[model samples]
Target: MHIITRCEEMKIWSLRKNKTPMLHYFLFAYWFILLVWQNLGAGGSANRGGMDVVIKCGLLVMLMIYYFMHATGIRRDILLMCMLLVGVYAIVKIEGGLDLSKILYYFFPFLFVLLIFGVGWKFELNKRQLVHLCNMLIVVVSYIAVYALIFCTDQFANAFSIDNAYGNELKSFLMSSHEYGMYLVFGIMAIILCMEFDPEGTKNRRFWYFLALILFSVNLILTFSRTSILSLAVLLIFYVLIFAKKRLRNWFLILAGIAVLMVLVIPSLRNFFWEIVMKENNDAGRDALIDFGMAFYRDGSVSQKLFGWDYAPIKAYLASSRGLGSFHNAYVQQIVANGLLGVFIMIMYSVVTLYDIFRTIKTKKEGSHLSKFFISFAASAVVFMTFNTAALFASAIDSYFMTLFTVVVPKYVNQSIRAGTFDVPIKNRETRPNVRRVYR
Candidate 1:
């Protein structure tokens, strides 16, 4: 009886301290599970009526409820309008528009809103909180990844079966199709983690970060994903060169040492790396897809060319003509699906967020941990996007990260604006100090 009373007391204390319902945690978990499972090709349409649909629907509903709870504003309203337009466009083209699996895309605005305002618009995670959350996530995922590697290798090698205990496919280079997505997510996470630990200032942190780099690098290699391998390397190099707080020469030396060690220690990796870079057929069918997309852009009917082919048409085109699900190139996917206009908007949105993140990095009062981490995150994200379609508009992970940063960064800018500490953007059409104006 005493233990039960103490448990109840603790629960109430946690609730009051966060001032958020327990439901927020549940929704977050559900969303994360969905995110992880997206790589596995789980439910994405209503026709299947699977558990994925149920989970996605639950997430959408919960987020919408959260949005209303926080009181709607014009900014959110305008964003939602744009999202709805895009969602409608995405749906009319796809086969199962309002189905269970595809519902997640339809409600992306809800996800963005929930992240920003679900709990009284308190989405601004300060430097400490961001580092804490990202690092904790990395530690948890990295442990699972390591365990998966050993367990899958042993279990699959002996039994000659596909399934492993850790829920990855044993025989393939990647434990699962989701490996690409995981690489993208965790690759960014690793950069932020290293930035948090100080890329150059301290010896102890450098030691731990190098360990993390090795682990994440190995994880990327084992997955055998060329896109991930390239992106992860780009992220690490950028973190060292652009975001590190230490000496540039030393940073280059450390990166060089790691590269040399990797080549020497992992014989198979050297072969794989060379094959991806030096081999002829490195594009993995991207060339053909681009041809088809460009051809369609040139020859398709007026309406088809304007909106491009809808989802159904594109899927149909792929199946009847080429036999595939997507164009596999994000930029082409945008052009094929929604025409040049949609592609333009998508690019602009990405550019806007990237601009904001870098702008904030420039404003970092020297010696602030937050500035360094933000710069690292931004750099990793930018470099990763160049090589991976996972950052494309169709991917929920890209949308989630971009929207979260968009809303949060502006808050910091608002603080700067109020303090009259305009750091960058010296252009002055109006003689009033060239700081960002606070949204009314």
Candidate 2:
């Protein structure tokens, strides 16, 4: 729980009012490398133990080191805060009489996020650059989509067992469908934002973006991951009710009606969708995991509850269950991995984020209609990560785009929305601050 979050305000959320941006051109190459590495199918071993982890962590360290040469406000504060976290973690291990070498495996992987936050915390971008970033995210999805097409041609070809009803789940290159599903959530949102914000002067761009959006949605559904599906559903509802245009809402409703009609009229489709939902709806494993986690916490020593055990402590349970690994529940997973203090920090982070989002909705400027929209995306993204994902630190791709959208890009959009600059004519723009204006 030693987040030292008071330090969050020590640096702004990386939003600056500068007209010219400090470009990190290396990011594009970095992201492309991540994309290829992930889809290379090296499996979790590659991700967790191989040079992949070293390369990622090393690249981030280099970036932060370079950043310190010119860093001032947010970058410095955020990096120092991250160092504070590492200090707290090390102190807990040393004071708790645990071997730091044994826990280093658990500790080092998390440094990637800390390093990324240090570099990205105060990173700046113009509106056009943000749109380009989102476009690149869409390209990530497009690559995955094509990969899915090539591999999951049957959509149900990769059956687990004869007894397993949820057959042929689309995992793409990922071993778990949920990871791919989570990856698509951010990609889907990126497409939506890009569709709304990307330059419109280019011909047929909307058609292509919309087509990609449809494709991404289909792939997500085919993942058949309950948590991911629910996460996307919540995000879509937030978009429609809070930010979408009336016509768009109506269109969404119409599409819903058509989808329902097709499901009802087609017996096979209805059964398939129903089976996807009910496959493990009554699975007792999750409840049992929760029971075990709570029981362990209640019976453990005070130190144990403060910092979790290095091991899963559920190896017996794992031996009996088929394909079941760690706890599927994120909160329980956090409790087992980092202990009660970790869960407390996680919950407190969400509380802080939601409170800030509430303030954003309450204090929108007169003409900043999309402020609520931007805040809604940020809020839903935070909620989805806190409740659904097993880890708060995202994959390399999601880390890049999510940080850009939630923390880096919103200030520009919210400000331009307030100035009415996006919708205003070019002649009226002289009165506004000298910064990038997203023209409608």
Per-prediction TM-score to the true structure, in the order listed: 0.66, 0.74
- Clash pairs, candidate 1, are 44-101, 44-102, 45-101, 46-99, 46-100, 93-311, 93-312
Against the true structure, whose TM-score is highest?
A: 2
lDDT of each: 0.48, 0.58
- Give the TM-score comparing model 2 with the true structure, all chains together: 0.74
Error of 2 at 366 (Å): 9.5
Q: Give per-residue lDDT, candidate 2, residue 93.
A: 59
Q: Write the per-residue lDDT of candidate 2 for residues 254-369, one digit (tens) a residue.
A: 99889889988997667666666446475536677677767866776776678765543354465476356666566676676678876775565445445544554565654344
lDDT minimum window of 10 residues, candidate 2: 431-440
Judge candidate 1 at residue 243 and give its lDDT.
Answer: 62
The window of 10 residues in a row where model 1 has the poorest summed lDDT is 9-18
Model 1 segments more than 4 A misplaced = 1-31, 35-50, 76-122, 154-181, 184-188, 191-212, 257-272, 276-281, 316-323, 366-388, 391-440
